[model samples]
Target: MKFAIISVTEQGHKLAKNLLEYLENDPSVIKVDVYHKNVNSTLNKCFEEYDCWVGIMASGIMVRSVCPLIKTKFTDPAVLVIGENGKHVISLLSGHMGGANHFAVKLAGMIGAVPVITTATDLAGKMGLDTLAYQYWLELDHRISIKNINQNIAAGGKVDLYLPTKFDFLKNHPIVNTSYKIDIWNKTFIQASFSGDEIVLTPRRMVAGVGSKKGVTEEQVFFALRSALQHLHLPLSRLDAIATADIKEDEEGIKLAAIKSDLPLMIKSLEEIRNFQHPDCTTSQLVKREFGVGGVSEPAALIEAGDNSRLILKKTAYNGVTVAVAVAI
Candidate 1:
């Protein structure tokens, strides 16, 4: 994830640079940029650009600067406040979904500072619903009463849990109320029949594996994808990713379609797909002759989704493209 460190004083600037060097060395941190001059202007202009913002200044200064910029917890970037002396790192805003609390603890460990996380769930030694959703990559409707649900969990209150059989792992989670029976949503979707008071987590586990001919347009790829999802009565929003073989990584059409559709383009190595064995996958002689693989779409989908994932929709040929869907276990 991208991070921006804002510093005001010369000491703060030095601290920010030190923090940036440490963050850059971490494998999980993708990019770290430090800004020392024009603090207010930089924060205003680049607030949305970075995934998280670390301010090496007074807590009041950082809070006032971000007050107007703060929107909702779901959309805003994680904000961390640190003193120039680097005595403490505080998760100031977007503590759950934006992962401010997680980053604060990590940064504190790197810099020998105290990590101050103020979220109730953290203090209660329980996982917040929003944090659980973010960690698991589960989709939550913005309209849901997430604040109340999180409050209930934080106060040692019970919240009913509903999940599919594949997500039974959540039953052992700290936030789950084991006393209540875990209601199962037998269908692919769990959002269709749930009350507002109950906490719901929608797992985005569908991967749409695609194979396309050379020089196909983005429209053609999108058409094939839409057709395949329609056959299964699933919406584009339900899809987690679009998978393809690494050999087709240079296919601009598939890449463009994934970008336009706001889906991740998951590319699997040809060797991985060749070795991936699935009984239900369709074997194509033409694919084997060309890419030395029995199939492209079906195997790619199952391989990228998970080991236990099964094909929800088999290979379906469309105009210049083949599509398959898999639900991750």
Candidate 2:
């Protein structure tokens, strides 16, 4: 995770430096930028850029400084406050979704400091719905009443938890089993819509397989992918990965499109795509002649999405690009 450390005082700078030293050696930490001066300007500049912000200052000062920039927890970065003496590390904001509370505890353990977590679920010895969503890489509908559901869980009240069969293992979690009344429903996360005022965590299980002619622009590929998803009435965020045949590994346009979409580019071998038996896979004589495969997009998507997967959208060609979408069973 990327981190930004803001320190207003010399003593706080020292603490920030110490924290940086600890974080730099950790393999999990991707990047860390330290700001020992111009606290206000630095906070404004780095707040949205980094995954988390560590303020080495007083709690009141940190809170007041971030108050103006604070937005919804879904998009905000995790915020933490650590005293100059490094005696305590407090999870100040975005405790659940942004992972401030979990990181605070981990940071405190690293530096031999006390971690102060004030979130209700953590205090009640129960995992919050937001935390579960963050930890398991599940997407929550921001429109839902998450606060009320978490409050219910903390109050020893049971909340309905819906899960696909693939995620049945989560039922074994001690807190989840106790706090939620789970129903195993085998369907897409979006298809299994909420039955009542309960928590619904959508698993990111869709893969978009792409096929494009050489020298095609990233815009063409991206537009094709977006168009295919739009046809299904799904958002771009619902896609988990962009898949293509291994022969097109050097195709910069497809690669750039995947990068621009912020999704992983999964390459499936030609043999895998050819051997796969899917009735919906389009028969392309040109593709068979060029790459020895009947199709690229449909089978590649189905292969990357794994076993028991089904094509949600069949191959749709746009300009020189072809796009298909598949969902894991």
Candidate 3:
């Protein structure tokens, strides 16, 4: 995710730089662009390019800058305002869907500031499904349903809740008076039915490790990727990210495929991928000769999923492309 850190003074600039250094290495924090002076115009000019905004100035300035750009909480970026002296960080807009509420608490901790949150759901100590969906990287079957749920909760309306399985954390989550019966994880999504403003959240749990020959066509790569996931009883929507060896960074087939589908592509170094081992994954002498690695797909997937990855599917060949699957720990 990207953040636009807007500051007005030298002190604010210092705070912005400090935050950038602190969060620079986090994988989820892709970019933290710092802007000083004329923050309102700059933010007004480039608001869409960022995921969130951190204003290190007066709350009035923040309000004036973001008020004109406000659309809906669902589509707007999460915004937080930190006092110029850095004593308070307030969730200015897009509290839940934009993640400003959660990020406010975190950023406040970094700077010894108090987080000011006015969202009704948060003050009531309830967790809406939309927040969970965003946190888990799950896509809601209907965005409107989640928004409705949050709206009702904010209005002090009582609503019954349901969950398929017990998540230890959700047990104490913001949802009040919810019951559990079945396992949502194992239930077939196609046959499942929910009523009365219930939200359907689809978890993106799969990551595909791909290996392609030089000059592979995007058509062949897409066909092979979809076919592999279908065999595993999962759909393309459930695919989280794409993984491949860094050596294939210039490979247009997978690059274009990821762009076309709008998936996060993780390309690890050849040595990093080769350092890991999969019991069932095959190592080609030919591949080792050209790329200094025995296999690309499986190991790349494993590395992308980190050390605690559980391999679900081994290398499966399709034409000139190979595919693998792993779940992160």
Q: What's each prediction's TM-score?
A: 0.61, 0.62, 0.59
Cand. 3 TM to true fold: 0.59
Colliding residue pairs in candidate 2: none
Ranking by TM-score: 2, 1, 3
- The sequence of per-residue lDDT tens digits that candidate 3 reaches over residues 1-329 is 56889889999899889888865644235457788899767987999877789989988888887888889877799999997788888999888778898889878888788999997777877666566555544456667666566666566654453343322234443353332222334442311123465556555456889998888988888888888776554555456689998788898999998887678889888777667775545688989998778899888877776666656566777899998877664
* Candidate 2 structure, TM-score to reference: 0.62
Per-residue C-alpha lDDT of model 1 across residues 1-329, encoded as one tens digit per residue: 57899999999999998998998765345468999868778989989988799999998989889998988899899999999999999999999999899889889998999999999877888776777666555667643687776676677765566666555555655445422335666754333222345444578588989998898889999998988877554457667789999988999999999998889999999999988887668689999999999888888889888878867677888888999888764
Give the alpha-carbon lDDT of every model: 0.80, 0.80, 0.73
lDDT (Cα, tens digit) per residue for candidate 2, span 1-329: 57898898899998888889988765335467898867777888768988789998888988888999989888899999999888999999999999899789878987899999998888998887788776655677754577777788898887777676656766777877776777778675622223365445677578988888888988998888888876554557568899999888888989999898889999999888878997556688998888888889889998998887767677778999988887775
Badly placed stretches (over 4 Å) of model 1 are 142-144, 175-185, 189-199, 205-329
CA deviation > 4 Å runs, candidate 2? 142-144, 190-195, 205-265, 268-329
